[model samples]
Target chain A: MGVTVLQIFPDSSRSGCLETEKLHKRIMHLDAVQCGMFTVDCDTCYTVTQTGNNRKLHIVHNSETPTTTYAILDTGTKQITLSADYLFDLLLPRLDFMYQSKKNLKIESKGAKYEIGDFVVKIGTVTMSGHYKAILVEVEYLPCHTPALCWSLMREFMQSFMGSCVKPTLPSYLQNRLHDIHTPQDTVQQYVEKFNEIREGTTFAGTQTTGSGS
Target chain B: MAMPVNVPHVGENLEAAMKSQIVPDQEFLLQGSVLDTSLGVVIDRLRGLCDNADILPETFHDHEVVFVLKDFSAMSTPGPASQGVMLRVRRAMDYPDLPYQLRYVGYPELGNYPALLRNCLDIPVSNNVCEFLTELGAKLDHEFIAKGFIMKKGRIKVTVFKMYKMGIGMAKDNLEQMTMSHMVELSVLTTKTDMSVAEDLRALADQLKPLVQLERIDYRRLGP
Candidate 1:
């Protein structure tokens, strides 16, 4: 409802005689309104771009229609000419819709993991590229590794960006591993092994290569 | 880079006379804060007069931009401005220097108070643009009115005479364009969450950048 604009490529001319049959079909169904153009008024013309050359056939209808719709065809170069009506009516609505979807959009990529820090790890991929950005959430490979940095890294790494939805159900044993992983000399691996011994299917962070079945 | 200079559309030998006031080749902000509406338009119509003239830099900002009144009454919140300041403005007719106008209104308004005009000048032009508007108000019935000159190179003088006219055509053009545009493009680069609209518009003073020409004085404003 605001403004309409058009952007046209500078060139498009001729629909050769060889393509006469196709050209006849187009004109029979064109919305040729009565419109006189600028100083150089252009009528609908057919164009055929060959591999090495281009051709065209112009159909000049009588100036019988009211001067309402005119075509400003480019005779020289290839260009993108926008329909005036389409610019304001069609494009504006699209832009408004796009803008509506512009806030707090969320995304996710499951089963991914990330190297959170020097001594910590988490499951997820970087969703954004900013200092305070978060990461996409991920599934666990281990139940332990309760370092606060590990938790923070997990929080950040698990936020993948795309669409938006909210849910709250974190991994189990998180509190226990967080406590043990922060201990002075205890390797997080040893704690993870103990957790795994008790619960054989604890998913862990980081890429682990295994050869055969246990 | 230096801003270009152009002499006024009045008098001969005037450029040489003004050149003596300048330091051989230095740009100067040739201001016209007159309430004279018609006179301002005449000066404005000569938009790129300083295009080829040599204007050495007196200040850091480069590129000389001419200011024209989009609406004179816009300056006064009053009707029908004067032409004297615009005429006195052709000071470059005497000096070989670059020129710039801080306040620009098209027609139907000019400053009414003398004190308001004077106070406009003495203040610094860099930090406070509002002060620039006041100085735009400063020239009405001013001490600098009718005649002015630079007391440089120890009394080398360039005489400036003042006059005025009504700029109706220019005013109509400004207002009409304000009301209707052929087309206006919305910015496509907006992010999903941009809260900067209010700030940018505020900086624009609720006016389109097209309605007025506030020439950039600081050419080399450094990094963030």
Candidate 2:
């Protein structure tokens, strides 16, 4: 519905709680109103080798858009995204012969949501198979649809609370879609990209391994 | 007599509840075709036999893309080989704003029934369905354009359309006809518990008797 930017808040202490609390305090200091909670979960299904070449399918569901299901198919070469009604969930089990769901690979991010003026901030704790993985912060600028037009203003707003972790430039996902009208699918795309990164045990962007933090 | 009367009422209530929650997935179908030259006469006949005979039949131009997902390893297996599931994506060419349709039709049930019954699911999907299906390893089998009239009589849908081959780069203009006949299909979607609708489909097909003999033509029986 708007331009959404997903940033990975680094967990230097290796415990996710402290970083999330610190971010929460900074956001609350900005007179932001706590607005319930949010969640975005993804289920990965891999194509059976007997069917063809191996591929990955990511089925994502966002609490904000409860009635919709976003399916991103990674064909090893390119990614194709399909947004369908929530009823699409029923069709997944029928595709078992072609794509086998990796039950243990299920990942989700859930945390408190905040509203400040036209911006909505969500700080989610990413967990894979119930194990703490990382921290993800999602900021959505409601008034603007094009990331190209709102990137600067959003960066300033994000920097107010997220500090240096907020990048000066657009996320790579938004770079190609800077001028395009942003949709809910774009938001989920960012989540899938970050989820995949966290799954691979990679370092978060804009964070140093200080090794000592409360 | 008293017990039978009470049982029907209870069964009807349960059936209604189940219908409210589950979509009808069984499609009872009958197919036949009329020659291109006789298409006008058949359309005129349908206009009278179908519902709302006063209004003109709704003409449609749809593009259908067929995708197949097959397990390559199944060819070597000894048991009944997998025929591979086929998914069809259909969108109206005249109405581009309408959502694309994703259709899954299973093999016809083998029985002594008067109509063809098969498991079917039709989901209105986003425009990105083609790309998603391809990414799911469903190979593009073929595509064609179907232009014709669609009429409805109660729950039964009657469609008489002619298929055309796509031009270069999937161009719509200057298309070539696939056959000399206009394929006529009479279908009704019903639930698994109800096989009674098959008779309705048969009755509708019988009306087009002389002009176009609609029958339960088993596609698999028609050799490749």
Candidate 3:
């Protein structure tokens, strides 16, 4: 019912022995879906944080779920994602704020997207404005949501493949918020940060040349 | 000589002291009104621009029955805090018309602009809604039928409707339409984090200039 996600990167390839027990190696296939995400705001605010009055709203629509709209409100330090069948009710008559964004970022993945015992691995690249931003490797332990409760177990699992990249620290957004209820918005906040970081005109050094899966 | 110590006591005075120091940020509400004389003409113009309109005339038939509840708790207050609460009832469109819809619509608080950031909460409509409101001492003030046309130009939703008062002992066919004007409201609900779309709204308003004056109207200033 819960999940613990770890972002990973590919470094050195293991030759023979490590590849034998790899679940993905035998199947070597996964049903991958291509996704494009765009973050929009009323031209006046940057991140939701700047929209200071009582509520800060952000709209992120993904191409994979073209019909579904995500409206996030950041109130105080708490972020509430509105769940409704009619999300357009909040988006339309764009009167109070004009929704605008520069471009949409695409995420394509490869490498071990299948489950390895209790963990599922996702190796993907995020691209925007025709440039690759960063390679994000996410490993999720399907059973737990609280990182503090299962950090050691997640670290032990990811350490098998990600090796030293498995830093045993939680994302800072979880600080003091570890005990709070976890929702999909926690994952959204992570993507929003990466989307914003790329939107701010920072290239991933020379990594811009890497293709979708490299 | 010992120095005199000034220690503040923690009670009503302390609470008031803390309240005075914390000021909430201002929200803005932008609104405009139009007379019935220009309703047809404005709607006609809106319909002409295909890229600007989705004029599903009947889909805008979002009929609402509004119930106003007074905060008698403020019976002692002579100020605006003594305002009544507004609740609405209607048939839930998504579900079979079995359950009625219930919601609380608060008046817009004073803010920086013509647009208001009012509080609205939706309560599930069930058999208990009536009993619950009754237990809270809510009274049925007046019920009206709001039939209107809603369209969107980009992100802004423009709602134009004429309110009709339910005639006493009236059948479904006997509702009386209020004759003053057709209320036209242009609004877009956004998170408080977004920037004001005043410039875009103003631009759209400019397109309909001279035909009708679309600007912010303070309902309070209009009087009860």
Best by DockQ: 2
The residue-by-residue lDDT of candidate 3 on A49-131, one tens digit each, is: 12233433454443223333345544455554533222233222221321232234333222224455566555444444445
Considering every candidate listed, which one attains the maximal lDDT? 2
User: What's model 2's lDDT at B24?
Assistant: 76
What is candidate 1's CA lDDT for residue B62?
Answer: 19
Q: Across residues B55-115, which tens digit of lDDT does each residue of candidate 1 receive?
A: 4212121111222221233334332232213211222222335332232211221233111
TM-scores, all candidates, are 0.13, 0.82, 0.40
Candidate 2 local lDDT, A1-214, one digit each (tens)? 7899998887777788988889889888899888777889899999765545788999888888766778899988888888876656656666777777898899988888889999999999999999999999999999999999999888888878877666677789999998999999889999999999999888554354332122
Where in model 1 is the C-alpha error above 4 Å?
A: A1-214, B1-91, B101-224
Q: Name the top TM-score candidate.
A: 2
1 or 2: which has the higher TM-score?
Answer: 2
**How much of the true A–B contact set does each candidate keep?**
0.00, 0.32, 0.00
Q: Rank candidates, lDDT, best first.
A: 2, 3, 1
TM-score of chain A of each: 0.18, 0.94, 0.59
Residue-wise C-alpha lDDT for candidate 1, range A25-64, written one tens digit per residue: 3322332121211111122232221122221211111111
For B1-224, candidate 3 gives per-residue lDDT tens digits of 12123212212232453356321122233445567877888778756642444544433433466654444444345543345455676653333445455655445666565455654434333433454344333477766676677677677666677777766675555567787677766665543345366456666667767765676665667776
List interface RMSDs for the candidates, in order.
Answer: 26.5, 11.8, 21.2
Candidate 2's TM-score: 0.82
lDDT values for all models: 0.23, 0.83, 0.48
